[model samples]
Target: MTCDYDVVIIGGGIIGSSLAAHLASEKNEKFKIAVINSTGLGMPASEAAAGLLTPFQLNELENPVRKDFCFKSFEYFPEFFETITSGSSAKHIDLGYRQAGSLYLIFSNSEFSQKENETRNLKTIEPRLSFLSKVEIPKYEPLITRDVIGAYHYPSEAYINNPKFLKAIYLYCIENKVEFLNTTVKKLNISSNIVENIVLDNGQVISAGKFVFCNGVWANNFLKEIFNTDKNIIKAIRGEIICVKALHAMPLRKIIFCSNGYMLPRPATNAFETDSVLIGSTSDEVDLDKIQPPLSNTVSGISSLINLFKTLVPDYKDYLVSGCWAGLRPQTKDNLPVIGKIPEIENLYCSLGHYRNGILTGPFSGKILKDLILENSTEYNIEPFQINRLFETQIRGIPKYASI
Candidate 1:
């Protein structure tokens, strides 16, 4: 009764790839691991993300639990990347990791006053946090529009190239002999509260000692299929982003945050590469099944993003439009990520509903899940992100804003 693989991980996005990297990095024993992706590698949200790692600016630090979760993940980035890139071919991959800091633009005096007080208190936690005057904003980012009144700056915030980060981890897993199958899991074979194996779309049955679902928005379908519940646990929030390239090298100094959207520099990886900026996003709730990958950007979405670009850097209005794309982010009713073993299914686990923090939290979440899979214990307190808590809470209507 030997299993084909020690672990079969469903989904190949950042979450799944990070988990694969973690499992592959195990020093004690080599586990037979497989990562299955229905969509192409790094297809949606992972690649489509603006890659802005500004957890402190967006009311993320308001909640103690969420603040701790995000900050811990933020601090773990260097070590996570180090571990994955140590022996992999992706060591040379430019993950676009930047610590240039993040700025939140202010349009009015009232808004400035409000943030001034907010930053005053936040400074206790982040000593470097400050509100830059309109006269001083240009010193940090000269390309910005003159219409901006001021901005709130968090010097320690950082960002990364989401796609390359995913690629780095994928390569690490491949280098460690983790198998990747580009296919969909059609069903699961559960017997007496334990998952025996997974059934693929082609009717191929693959046995595995353990199963982990990191399929993002698609987890809802799997949940309903496995638990036989009609409740909607995971919601798909579609986001659209546009990339604009400057004719000349107009390097952006820091990430920009505005009421309408955000702007971040997409640094040139090579000498021949030109400077570009990524502007995002519009959040629209869509049905789980409604999203077919290769998502297109709408005229309205593009126009809105363009307006954001113009408002942020009016001087860059003539910049070339390089590309536009969309992605679906998975979120739970509570907006906290789900990361733990499924109590009902002995060998089943999940790391879904990451929403906006997937890029920031993926690696640590993977570490936590890996610990739970091996020893049923973890260093971090994931009690708030448990799956059982989701089932205990009643389903609620989708909020006006899913994630910030």
Candidate 2:
């Protein structure tokens, strides 16, 4: 059967673009690939992200599978960032990649002891991290609030200028001859058990051998419509960030993280060209009862972030507010990403539900998906991320679309 392309990837965010780039750059194989996005590049999560790459900070006991996945993905960033930036079209792109590490602040004595144990256990996976005394905390971040009882430093962690990184990857994908279509996928044309065609918003039908959903939170509705499964496996969690420029030198050289949220030092935008710090965020799950919620900054969200800054940074008044924005993260029921192919639907694959770690895991997930499509193998076992697990734990009822 002749198809328009070998693969049709929906979504132009980090995951979709990365997959497009990886597939197009395969050494011996040439496959026609197209990336379709309703909105232009970086409209939602990818643009509003702070690009913190600290998977070591995750609590292993909480969700070990996700933690392990994040650590592996974080380890791949250095090489991944280098490769994407080295592309001919991406030569001038400055990703603002930094390995300055992250400080997880401890607030109470119990919290300090808890983190001490956590850091001790973390040494097996990440030996570069070390716990710091309250007195020693100021030595690392002079501007940290005195209320900190202690802190843990993950030296191997890093961050990037997300906007520039996305731009570079997008340009690199285009340079590699990956076509990007700016249109919304209205529906999936299915026959038997496979998706044979993608219907666009403009009533155009695109046929492809394989279809991958990298549309993040939007995938929830897409999956529901195509499979007739009403399960809300993925939902949008809105996160808000406030950008502040320093009046003097930069606030801190490293990322400061507390229980509530974290602060990131980001490169100044081209428009302003000033030193800036990013304070974020509020994880508000979208009310499923409402119509699709528009991504917008709210006064209450900004105020909550301001309170976080006041609690974490000393002399927070020294910084002037620059800007604020919000993005929706595709959070899953188990808080782990959904990867691999759909069980019943042949040639249908998904790499969504990344929540907050989308940017951190984007490169590696892309590589994994590319391997699955080309070599039919993966470096990491992807069974744990299969979409079937969502149906396996179905206490409410069987999946609405279950073919049984």
The numbered model that scores best in lDDT is 2
Give the alpha carbon lDDT tens digit for every residue of 181-265 in model 1.
Answer: 9888988877777788899988999999899999988788778766556777888888999988888646888998877888899
Clashing residue pairs in candidate 1 (N, C-alpha, C atoms within 3 angstroms):
none
Error of 2 at 322 (Å): 1.2
Local distance difference test values of all predictions, in order: 0.82, 0.83
Tell me how candidate 1 scores on lDDT: 0.82
Per-residue CA lDDT of model 2 for 21-135, tens digit only, reads 8898884236789999877323569888989998876774768899889988988877778878786467775567889888998889898877788788788877777888889
Clashes of each: 0, 0
